[model samples]
Target: LPAEKMAYLRSLQQKNKRVGMAGDGVNDAPALSQADVSFAMSTGTDVAIETADVTLLHGDISKISYCLSAAKITMNVIRQNLFWAFFYNIIAIPLAAGVFYPIWHISLNPMIAGIAMSLSSVTVVTNSLRLRMLIK
Candidate 1:
């Protein structure tokens, strides 16, 4: 029965699902190994700790919520950064390529183009750093 359950739990990864298992017993080792993210208590058996990706120091479950929240925030920051970076590239590349030169006779200077490129990079980085201000 344990073996069947273990295989069922491990099969989640084959379906392209991100599975997280929290186990402390020796029998939990196999399923924990199969999971993408395994949480084991610091006070768990040695084998459990060895198989887990994350070890709960005080065996506290509340930390799991904090971990999930941090991961969500990180994903949010990544999306925000990607949007601004792509926006900058989409607008700047055409301008730099002299797309406006024929109709408006407006040519982008190489020096100013370099400065603008640098500024966009700085903007993206600064925006990403906003995560540092999030409440812990």
Candidate 2:
């Protein structure tokens, strides 16, 4: 039974799956090392803290759920930031290159486009800062 847990973790990783393991760190060191994400309790052995990607400061297992939620939110923010960046490039680049002048009789000033592009980056940063509100 002692080895069953690590075997299961290893099997999941070998299958190219995302594996998360929570442990005291000493006995589970090998499994923790193999996991895609590992959580160690603050009260756990020193080896666990060193090996873990995250340490549960409260040493409560339930905190793992909070961490998971934060991770998901962080990933979603990243996706949104990337989408905004790509979208900005797609439209701004064409206008800046004067591609719209022949079709719409509108000539975009490069200076204005540059300002708009910079605002896109600022908006993304402001959006990402929303993550701080989640901490509590």
Give the clash count for each candidate. 0, 0
Error of 1 at 83 (Å): 1.4
Q: What lDDT tens digits, residue by residue, belong to model 1 across residues 42-78? A: 8889999999888888788668777777778988988
Q: Rate the local accuracy (lDDT) of all candidates.
A: 0.83, 0.87
lDDT for 77 in candidate 2 is 92
On TM-score, the leading prediction is 2
| Clashes by residue pair, model 2 | none
Cα deviation of 4 in candidate 2 (Å)? 4.8
**Which residues of candidate 2, in runs, are more than 4 Å off?**
1-4, 14-17
**Per-candidate TM-score against the hidden true structure:** 0.73, 0.85
Give the range of the ten consecutive residues with the poorest summed lDDT in model 1: 1-10
Roughly what TM-score does model 2 have, to 2 decimal places?
0.85
Off by over 4 Å in 1: 10-18, 45-47
TM-score of 1: 0.73
